[model samples]
Target: MFWKKFNLNKQYNILYLDYNATTPIDPRVLDAMLPFLKENFANPSSTHYFGSNINESVKTARIQVANLIGADETEIIFTSGSTEAINIAIKGVAENYINKGKHIITVSTEHKAVLDTCKYLETKGYEITYLPVQKNGLINLNELNKSLRSDTILVSVMYVNNETGVIQPIKEISALTHEIGALFMADATQAVGKIEIDVDDFGIDILCLSGHKMYAPKGIGALYVKKGIRLPAYTHGGGHENGLRSGTLNVPSIVALGKACEIAEQEMQQDAERIVSLRNELENELLKIPETFVNGSIENRIYNVSNICFKGCDANVMIGRMKNVAVSNGSACTSAVIEPSHVLAAMGLSDDYAFASLRFSLGKFNTKEEIKSVVEILKTELEFMNS
Candidate 1:
């Protein structure tokens, strides 16, 4: 166990395996944020001493977030969430680089944030190429290369698929995008704190990440724009975040996000080892049920996630049976829609199989005992289904 002794709130007593959807804020992160909420309540933009002190905290947050992704502090732009970050990265790039090209490339299995933003751009006369994924939920580099055009100004691919957890070949894709002088952007919401991510190492021109996906509060995220790359301002106001995003910073959440990043940097390796062990045990035991199989490229996925398909089992019904556990059929962002998962469909799953899938994303707080209990509950539920 990564945590020697941790106490979960009463409301969080049930097993939570939905880390990809959103993580529970770490107690330490909460502690770091409380001071900002209570005492340091001044606006960071004000010239007063209270504001200056808060502003300093925000700068510290910028450095912490930048350090996690190997970016410079000046390159980081604070946004409301990854959705806003995606909008800024895609739309800003489109606006600034439109003179060079009016085309964008992205994968079909991306989060709705990227896909919907691309669709919106299509209304503005920008051409978009939605690349297909293989049955293993992996993109074909050859197909991607073939899709690139001189007019392609950007290629937006996600570092990890929200449902399948399959990681993309970012380095290779970055090289391909750069060959045509286009910018490479990735939605790293699922990969950032879970895996070791260095934007410099990956040669990514723009990257988006959500604090809530790690152990931080929601409504806080950052976009890493490469030093030389210029993105047109998304919000037009006092020109905060290096004139890219404009607004008074959410000091409490910003502090929480920074503290969360610092902790993630320190405990990532240990967390991965322990979480992977629990996930493997859960997967192994869950697969014992008849007609069960894991989805996506298992070898190429993040350690904390396992998307499993229970053949002939309705995921909604399965979750209804396991009342004490928290899981999801797909991205929580799309939970309101009662249709089959778009991510699974892109991987060539039939509507039936897609609806039958469940995403089990573990986290640092999960323990061996919790894994065992969940596995037993699943076995019981499967038996009941057969009966």
Candidate 2:
């Protein structure tokens, strides 16, 4: 949609609802990053004193990231993104510090980062239990408890369902996980900046987040591993990111992320009220069409996300008709294929409904007028499709 303002001649102005996939960088965030990219270019790992000055920006970002999750700065380790942070969280913990225990537990509805990582670990002789999702894409606490055994080393669950906007019962899960002395890991990529979180109060041992998700630049994110936890390192280089992830620290993106976090900390409450209201208005208007239903009936779903399933219209057809609405099929990372989203299938949706699901994600810039017009367009298109 950002591209549309420049090309105003295009008919049917576009709307973006794919915030679950990614969000546009807030202008303030971009402004904060400008100096690091252009003038203050410096490697945070450099030995020279001048370039090393960039570490201040990186440290500030670290505090910002820490603030969002209620984590300590020492607990945060910078990485390329959520995918990399997830890899470090799981593999680093599993491989470097292998115990006699080889059992791990993760939900079937987990992001590809968790599921795919578990699958790869399977080849390495580790046993994993893929927990099933309820019809609403939430895992059963009893089932999770039943799966945990004496040999369980880790339990990874996402804090929020990316496709359905379902928020998991993290406190309950974390409490149960720690009771058995197993580590609890959370892929907080979808929850951070949009919801409230606290690392210590929630009993989280490991957590992953993406800077891009919070209005910062992509190619940078952070992993939080609680202090006193001896997880193994994934990256081996000149020792960056506490030697957990080895790379020259991304100074520019790091600075941007810190600034984004600062803004998120200050504006989270207001943003939640506004974004949630916008999404609700959107759902109310669009649901006026016959045979369209919300997939997950979560009362406490993320404020910016609304997953709607139009019974007959194909996702591709809907997308074609919707125009510049930068929304998604289910998940943006997995939209490259013709597959009916695995997430919807896991949530027990039939192919017809799953294929019809569209994710509209809101951001700091989305307006109510834009949402209203989007619904009007959908109403017209649905009528045409039915005709």
Candidate 3:
């Protein structure tokens, strides 16, 4: 009976504040991608009329993705997602630049993708220096400077910490990396589309991003390789994606990603202003609860994320008690593990504080009313926990 009057297409009941995990695909993106999936179902590599048209669509998508990050069209390489991109960037650099150096530099707060890749390299005898972060989740530049060695081949840092939303000083780090002749690579999955990214301006030699994080369909991502940077192919076969990657292109998803990037470039500023206001309101209200603390650098954080530690409260219990709200203690990638957040732990947070943290990330579709309701839900759940 309720569904008789309610339009399911536009209606939502869950107070979703987990945009960091992934965003719901935009309708516009779906609209743009449908043709590729249905009528234009042809291989881009095929020597036929359908293939020719599809190839043009793929090229257009590539340019759209490239333009979002201020990269040349030739520099974009589509991948399954950021994880794959990270693997390509890290392993490619390690393999190609091994002659130049067997050392890589990264921050302790980097996503597991970068850390695990470096760890794998460690098995091959490559040295990895994981620079620690200060209590505010900011890496120590001086420590970084000291860690750079003549043999350092790559320095991988994320543009934003997925859990804490703390933005790294990418430009400065890029400068430092170049000074040592090491390539600078960034996992920008959490930063791209949420913020303005100019790969050239940031001096980032390689950048990776996921379309799912920015209102596109999942399983679509792209890596930006600055021109002239040589990375060994991530996959071997048909030599697609300029021979850097080889696969039959997922044309529908690629088209969706391109459309999402186009929308992001056009609406980022407006979306940021609105989302930040809602995020601030929710955060301020939630922090009013006694013993609650904000995690990481408040000033340097991105507009849409607020990671808060509810002292003496169990994050899992609180989440379970809060009805109609969707939030997380940390990254979805690490949610299966019942462990404290590595990002918070890397910033010197105690085990209890790390376990008590919850990440609230807002998105374009969320409303101020939703933020208020989430705050109220949190308040009720926290009070119950305290009692």
- Estimated TM-score for each candidate: 0.97, 0.95, 0.97
Model 3 regions more than 4 Å off = 1-10
Q: After superposition, how far is residue 214 of candidate 2 from its true place, in Å?
A: 1.3
Error of 3 at 156 (Å): 0.4
Q: Write the per-residue lDDT of candidate 1 for residues 1-387, one digit (tens) a residue.
A: 436456342345788888899998898999999999898999999999999999999999999999999999999999888999999899998999988999999999999999999999999999999999999999999999999999999999999888888999999999999999999999999988888899988999899999999999999999999999988888889989899878788999999999999998998988998989999999998887778898899888989889999988888898887888888997889898888999999889999998889999998888887887788887788778768
| lDDT of each residue in 147-245, candidate 3, tens digit only | 999999999999888999999999999999899888999999999998988988899899999999999999999999899989888889999998999
Is 1 or 3 the stronger prediction by TM-score? 1
Which candidate has the highest TM-score of all?
1
Best by lDDT: 1
lDDT of 2 by residue, 15-68 (tens): 666777877788778889898878788677676986678887788889988998
lDDT of 2: 0.84
Each candidate's number of clashing pairs is 0, 6, 0
Sliding window of 10 residues with minimal summed lDDT for model 1: 1-10
Candidate 2: segments with Cα more than 4 A from true spot = 1-13
What 10-residue stretch in candidate 2 is worst by lDDT?
A: 1-10
**Model 1: CA > 4 A from native:** 7-11
lDDT of 1: 0.90
**By TM-score: ranked, best first:** 1, 3, 2
